[model samples]
Target chain A: MTASRFSPRRLAATFSLGLALASGAAFAANEQYFPLQSYRVGPYAAGGTGFFGGFIDYMQLINARDGGVNGVKLTWSECETEYVVEKGVECYERLKKGLNGAPAAATNPLSVGIAYATLERSTADKIPLITINHGRTDSTDGSVFPYVFPLQLNPYSEVSAIVNYIGQKAGGLDKLKGKKIVTLYHGSPYGKETIPILDILAKKYGFSVTHIEVPHPGTEQQSQWLNIRRIKPEWVILRGWGVMNPVALKTAAKTGFPADRVIGNIWSNSEDDAAPAGDAAKGFISITTHPAGTDFPVLKDIDKQVVKAGKGNLQDPKRFGNVYYNLGVVNGILNVEAVRIAQAKFGKRPLSGEEVRWGFEHLNIDNKRLQELGAVGLVQNLKLSCADHEGGGAVRFQQWDGARWKVISDWVQADRALLRPIIEKSAAAYAKEKGITPRNCAKEG
Target chain B: MDFFLEVLIGGLLAGVMYSMVAIGFVLIFKASGVFNFAQGSMVLFAALTFVSLLERGFAFWSAFAATLASMLVLAWAIERGVLRHLVNRPPITLFMATLGVSFIIEGLAQLLWGAQVHGLELGIKDEPLEFGGVLLSSFDLFAAGTAAALVLALSLLFSRTRIGLSLRAVADDPLAALSVGIRLQRIWGVVWAVAGFVSLVAGLLWGARLGVQFSLSLVVLKALPVLIIGGFSSIGGAIVGGLIVGASEKLAEVYVGPLIGDGLENWFPYVLALLFLLVRPAGLFGERAIERV
Candidate 1:
């Protein structure tokens, strides 16, 4: 087999075969293609595997069990980013549409930096970018961020809930006066997103706030935890990512800061983070919008249809009902529900990017609706609208018991009324800087 | 004063941990003239293999033995497949080859052991021991003990063993050692095996602290500066260099970091190593490569 044997004729024939196979797999009438930006390889891969795995498992189960979103099968493909912003955008440009030339129904940039990077492009592409538990805090303002949806909770609302929960823990908001609060944050845009909101709440409630930054891939946090020791703050708000969360718990224990006194943001709430830290993470508190555990009615179906059928992507079945996994399931449900709602108006055919965008804006997953979907206690009632992309979701605090996470607090709404001016202010600043014309939803609706 | 002592003590403990990995690099570089940039990836692979075996119902001791056996095989394979071919190559070429090896090993480790994070408990209680009002991590003290024992064993091996003498000769002059009829390839194999053993120790310690995952390999980046400050081919220098980098970075972060919005621990080590290079051109222990032109 010399070079003379590999003729152009043979090359053309092979090329034609590949093209024919690719074209044959083109757009179907009742199938909605989704492009999921996943980071299965990276420093944060521990969280990525469980979250993306669970999300993918849920989406696959829906196709296998219920056949899809109202007879329209969901199709999706993943591009690895390793959580790098540039790679995320590269993935977006490559996967913005499928082989059919039709744009994807929605894009989920799970990383905050990716969400921010994709915000402008998604709007220009007329595709909905869902940043479920992350993204810019101001993206909560639907008027400014029309194409972007931070569905469950934006950073602002999420941190506000943490502050409100802290108030509850102290007996009352009035008692929060003169209390010392510490914000141990990952030194990134995602971690810093909660700082301004904390400052706002701290001032309004008369609590003093001190925020310490933890550098990325934060496998060590001795200095910051020791600072917490010196400051002796009553509460520590841990806005961490990946390994930082567990290190924070361990350092806190070593510093004699009670794990119960430290509250983590949603990103730090995963079993991946706590499980590694072992007993040091016991009594560690974090916020959540979705319920954790395998006892959920939806997971039962997922187990039978997805896991039993060998369709689930989980490496270990033990991770089936963990925090990040459940969050992935919730994220999958949210995307599916939006598609189902879009199908209501856009006919029984495949939904377009615009129709799905409309669906995300008008989604109403109330408790009763959740009950009907077999997600009874798994989801809280969410009502996203033209002006509120975040749906004003409530957050519950969960504490890590030795082996598992258990809910420790009732659902609490963020001090949203106090946060309204701040949200609008930041959104207005973002609009001005980006020269984005804020949509008049009152007129458009 | 207690606060200062605590910070100082914490930094030294961390330095000891970093040296555990740095020594792995020194062993190979000293004997084979290869930087072995894959040292971190090797650590990660060793830990991942050991823990993954434990997850599969192997007892801890059996899993550990299997991991060591795997490392032994790995060292032989590297010598036979890669290093044997690249013998006497330019230093940069050998270095680049090891980088490629690192990528391959990282991918293989993740593939063979699964990409999920696994908790590796050495059953060493992590509670900090208190003395007068200062706290010291017991696990770190245990790590220091491990480091000390390994140092003693390595000292004895280098001073008394026949193979160790041949390795020193090879390091002194490869051509001369070849003229003297020493099997240069076999020494390279032995050097890589020793590196592999040191890597396993470093991996288990770090994996116990940070858990066994793909990111465990990134510790190599940290070990590079330790090698620079300590000398590329001196095991004793690696220990001292790790301590200096570790303690100074911690103290800098605590005392000077907050003044500059903090997070100096990330770059302080590199800057310190760079400054140290001004004083010790060949590192604190590295030999100067001189030509009698």
Candidate 2:
């Protein structure tokens, strides 16, 4: 029946339609989307599943427990990259427009190849590309890479921290003088990124260093290890990935090299890397931005709230607190915190990718904040600025005991004071090559 | 001199591992006249299945038997689904089919077992044993022994058995063999099944060396030069090719590598294979194909 606009029934219908429209707008405006370019079925799937699972689980925990951060719901959708660069770029191009009217907060691919491939695209989209714990060393200079955040650690800082750890182990920095060290690096851009920095460190410390390259998917490394044996280096810095780590340890054993002297880098620090080598990896040490284990209060909460509630993202519960999984949790914490910090500045709403970049730049998680977030030891004190994308360059050393990682040292800070000049120099070269004006950090708010 | 001996011995052992992978390719190529690029994927699938079973509390032999059975089924399926449809097709067609099969098997394996790196402990110690003045890997020695045993058994199977004669006949001329009532399907099925078993052996050895993961499929790259140098159709040739590739690449990396650049071991074998191709088009052991112009 046709009714008058002012009639009681007509008025009720109009009011209901208005409420529905308003609620829809609120739902759209009060959500943040994270485009996950994840690889859960590939050579690197062990890392992919653990990391993305942890990231998704942490986000789920936030949604279930906190009802979203400041009433802004966290949402994400995955595009399977299989850790391939082309697929990652395709995923970024596909998902960068955001989902369901909600703007994308960031894109985390968790791959060096993919991250580098999408660096320009993410910048063009004004979306923050978070490459936590691993990325190009030059990306540390945030002024040149405004939309890129190599959070926690960059490759240069990682190597610097490794050298610092070596120095510490050798009694002092001066004791490294005239000592021999070998760096057995994977054959890739990511693996070769630190060679120059290593040479510089060696010159500064007066240590004799040798660099050996192992080709990609490094399943065989007999020649390289034999070279190491011949060099008789005091320590071997293993910059390995995937199967290379296990093969290195096994070959090192065959060459009569003590496993305790082999220091694995960030990528090689996981249980996936060590367990395959069995007893050969017993005393192997590696540097990590975050330690693995379920002892953290945040992890306990996640286990109780998200996992027990049957909303967890992980397929296997055993990997809940593993290295890659914990890194994913730490990444989730950092991403959410950036959103919260941005919300504080830009009002409580779904902020744009540009706004998230500002939040990332101003991120400063001190000891108190770490404790408050129940991530005191899980995450080190981090402070990012307009000029620095890597908030924390510190790492903790851990040793494999044939089963799990045991934290062996407190947070060891990288030589950022020495690395900044090099980072700026490389960044300036990049800026010139790209014909882009670098951002002035001092002038930025 | 001692360092030279050590490097040479290490290279030889490493070559034996490559020989193990090449043997799979040799078996398939000899029987079906198709270069099974999927042999690498088969290795990955076999190892992943076995390790996955072990993780689920199956004993060694049980897991092994289950994996063997599954591989045989996979062989049967490949013969029925792919090879049967493409009878009398060009060699390139069969090669392309196996390439497609590789991707499917890789995806299916991961889909079924999940993509986690599993450590395989064969209870053989990998420590170095001092042989006179040179240090040698005990694990390498054990692997060499296994390779020797495998070669001996394979040689006997190809030369002595009725299936072996039928397989050789099929390889020479499938049409002729079919005309003689060789039951080409049965021969193909048997060869593929035996190739699957070879894949299982190679998978366990390579998996123990480089964790059971997706990269296990990439070990096929190492087999390529071996296949070229040893001739694709000869199991004995694969062994000889592997030894040459392994020893030469290692020795080159140690000696000639520093003179040029480092990390030549990956490509040095290719250089040797290219030279071999230039000098002998059919390879040292490969039979020269005489096609009527």
- Report the lDDT tens digits of candidate 1 across residue range B135-206: 888888999999999998998888899998999999999999999999999999998888889989999998
Q: Candidate 2 clash total?
A: 0
Task: State the C-alpha lDDT per candidate.
Answer: 0.85, 0.93
Candidate 1 clashing pairs?
Answer: none
Cα lDDT, model 2, residue A286 = 97
Which portions of model 2 miss their true places by more than 4 Å?
A1-23
For each candidate, give its TM-score against the true structure.
0.94, 0.97
- Highest DockQ among the candidates is held by which one? 2
Please give the C-alpha DockQ score of model 1: 0.40
User: In candidate 2, what are the lDDT values of residues A27-91, reduced to their tens digit?
Assistant: 76678999999999878999999999999999998999999989999999999999989999999
Worst 10 residues of 2 chain B by lDDT: B280-289
Alpha-carbon deviation at B62 in model 2, angstroms: 1.2
